[model samples]
Target chain A: MKLLELRGLAASVDEKQILNGIDLTVNAGEVHAIMGPNGSGKSTLSNILGGRDGYTVTEGEIELMGAPVNGMSVEERALTGLFLGFQHPIEIPGVTNMEFLKVAIDSHRISLGEEEMNTRDFMVQVRDISKRLELSTEFLKRFVNVGFSGGEKKRNEILQLMLLQPRLAFLDETDSGLDVDALQVVARGINEFRSDENGVVLVTHYQRLLNYVNVDFVHIMINGTIVKSGDAQLAHEVETHGYTGLGEA
Target chain B: MAVPQPANTLQGDLLKRVLAHEVQETPWLDRSASKSLLNCNGFPFPWKGRWQYSDFRALVEDALSLEGAHNALQSSHDVDVRRFDQPETEAQTMEFGSSDGVGDFPLIDINGVLFRSGTKLSSIAKTGSVKVNDANGSVDRHLMSIEQDAGMTVEETFKTGNRVVLCHVRDNAKLEYELTMPHGEGIGYHCLVVWLAKGSTFELHLASKGAQVRRNDVIVNVLGENATATLSGGWFVDGSDHLDSQVYMNHRVGGSHSEQSFHGVVDDRARSVFSGFIHIDRNASATEAHLTNRNIALSTQARAHAQPELEIYTDDVICSHGATTGHLDDDSLFLLRSRGIGEESARAMLTKGFLRQVVHSEGGTSLLNL
Candidate 1:
């Protein structure tokens, strides 16, 4: 089944056009890498898809699980199994990481008419996932993303992805600012969560992350629209020839 | 000195009633201080530098009207658990000076006069100290609990009946004081005066919920060198409740330190006023003092007034004060919502966490539950 489909998606910030005529689709079990240059509206597309405010969709249609999601609120979209991993995770002081995760998971469960996770079981699940992500149990006691290193913030995002287990995830430049070791750890987390029941849209500039997390399709975005779509080899071609080389294609 | 009548009729009537109460005999009473306090018209209003952001006229009137009624001075005794006094020694009978005219509020003066008039007082003494060394080479000192015999636990509700508390932490002693105010009707006032001797340490934890009018005035005098004091509290206000608190940390000698952290959450048409003043005397060289007041307004009609002031005369001292009032962070809200948390739940969690940060501990947990 098609997990997410965006047709002729055009959005603008403050009356300035950003994403122009963006059309993309992701089927279940597919991993699509979106490579773009600076100001190419890559982040804009991710934000609009997540239903963030301040971005006006001039002309577009966004569907999740074959249902229209253009009018849904951010939380509503999230409750429907759509997640957006921010490039720069915000630091929320005073809210413990564990408390935030519990609320997020419980909210989703309650919306789906499922019972809330008990403390013992919730802690067990969190411990298992945290260990896999190389996170200390002490990290759960601290405020969400507060005072965390750049690499820690990226790992925290992947941690949420694993716990929330959204059917469709948009990772916008999640590999930025991560060292090779941290990148490998984050990639392993992503690989562990990927399956036939869900899909991922990897929005990044480098092919390094693609190497770790297999990508079925590569789309080169320039000037707010996808200019080229090809197999995984296209990512290496862009890496070798640069974005300007693709502009002439 | 003859008592002066306040020009304001309502205030004058209230002062007369207060002065008419029989003066209780006590060896610690300072007649001169009481006489001088009676001569003042009334507590200062917002025009006064110290009371710039708080007004007590309405609260005073409401309290005075209940003075002689049946429900007047309803002694719930719940809040009385927080009252801790030291055995009176010759050293504790020092002259009671008038308000320093800068940091002291009129409510404190009223409390002083009433205290001299023999209000109910309690005493709790420390037998021995428990000191534990930390990994950082610092020592954790534990003093006697206020409720030593009753098991160290706080009561859920603080029925704010009019009362006066006199606390003394002697040399080389340490003490922790906790107080929680519950929701109630009518106006309530509580006054606490603490004296710290040389080498003494004092920590205070205060928490209050919504009420018609609840006011707490705390005065701490670091009388000797090497004395330290830490004050932290949280207040939650909803509906039309009004919560006003004032803290005065007086560093009278050199080498003294003091710190204060207070947080408040105002909802609906509720309002809160927090005024913290740290006064470093001219001779209090090498003294260090810091104060921070943080507040969040949950509704458009809710209001919060925070004034953190520092008065330092010694050039060798370090003192700083800061106050901030605003709604919850938008980025924080977005972050929570993006994680699938509902908007209302997200707001509630953030507000609770904000207050919890100020009063985070076993003692604080009880207060939050209230």
Candidate 2:
């Protein structure tokens, strides 16, 4: 069974079409890069897969691990190993990051009939992952995302990506608003999360992220659907020549 | 659940009955309250921002139900307590619900007030606990004073009652007072009025939850230069509960600082009303003050009203006020739910975070069953 698949997916928000008959398939161990111009429905597609509200799926079928993703709640999808890293992680004051991630991980384990993690072992694991992501363990004690810089927010999202270890990770513009150094850190975290048992669909705007995290397929999205699909060379071409003629072709 | 009390109209005679039946010759019970009490004129109709969303007529009548006063807060041996008339306090002058445009709340007469004798509070800093052991009463009044250059920490608790604590922090003194209002089905009206003299510091942390009717008021007057006051509170209400929290900060002197922040969570058919008013007197130059009140409604039927007001009459003053009344941020909730947390648990976590923004465990936990 494929990890994630979108068939004839069309979506709209506020009575306006955003995704017009888009089709994509993500198999295990495969990384797909979905690059799009502004208002090209790349975010709409990611949001639709993540079950975010305010988006009306006019016509589409989302399948995760061969099971129809329709009618599944947001948390249900997450428990089923579907994680979408938001571009902008919100600030939740008064909730420690450690507590938030622990609860999330505990929920995932309970759904899989696994016991809760040992607190001591969990802390060790958190420290190790945070160190690898170049984040201070002190951040785990602070409130989630409060007073966090743009780069810090992006790195925190990557931290979640490594902790949850879901089957399919759909990241939405996670590299935007990040410096070169912070971008490399984020890319490294994403690269570490890649494995033969999982799939990743990176929704991005620039090829800089692709330089660090190689993708098997690069799909250039214009209007509402993928206008062009090729190997990593497609992203480099779009960067040099732009989508001026690519969309028309 | 409908309030067990009938939808009785607030009669004019109610004020006269309170004064005639229970009148103490104290500054807190001064006749100044009579005008505001009668001005209510039978609680204005819905709209015009007067007693619209939540009504206190039930709590008023409930507080005045019994004849004579339930016992004043009995102080244990560790704490010193006295009557309002015991200390020579400045008489009369304190007014309520005037010139703030906050809401036309009725002013109930002060029944019985307890004042801690100021003779013991000395220049040295000390820690003291004031327990309202039997404070469950129709009305309870407490007056305290921290002497010049003195410092003390006070913690008070009450089950179900109306309490008014008027404190005087002399010049160069510091006081930290934490108030805990427990969960009860009865009614309560609690008010804490403080006067901070020159260079004095005052902090009041309060946690209130679950009552048929619970009213809280924190009024502070920065009367001296360099005086500072920080007031914070958290309230949780659900299942037909009603919480009314009002804050008033008067910066009358220059070089003073004050911040007022409160957060509350409303669920089910419960209701919460929060109004914060910061007044910077013309002479209050170089004063800095901020007021914030945040409320979150968990249910569609739940209601939250936040009104933060500022009246700055002086320049070179950093003064601002903000109030927001709405549901928890959808993005925050989605962030949690997208991480595999169940919807119900994620919402509860967000709701707790919303309230904990201002209220901390160091103060106390009084969220009914939170």
| lDDT values for all models | 0.74, 0.76
Fnat value of model 1: 0.73
Clashing pairs in 2: B113-B141, B114-B141
Please list the residue runs of candidate 2 whose C-alpha ends up more than 4 Å from where it truly belongs after superposition: B1-12, B22-60, B66-108, B112-124, B361-363, B366-370
With candidate 2 superimposed using the best TM-score fit, by how many Å does residue A246's alpha carbon deviate from the native? 1.3
Using lDDT as the measure, the top candidate is 2
List pairs with backbone clashes in candidate 1.
B24-B117
TM-score of 2: 0.87
lDDT of 2 at B299: 89
- TM-scores, one per candidate: 0.85, 0.87
Question: TM-score: which candidate is best?
Answer: 2
Note each model's CA RMSD in angstroms: 7.2, 5.2
lDDT of 1: 0.74
Question: B168-258 in candidate 2: lDDT tens per residue?
Answer: 7999988887787767677777777788999999988878776777777777888999999988878887899887777888888899999
lDDT of 1 at A214: 94
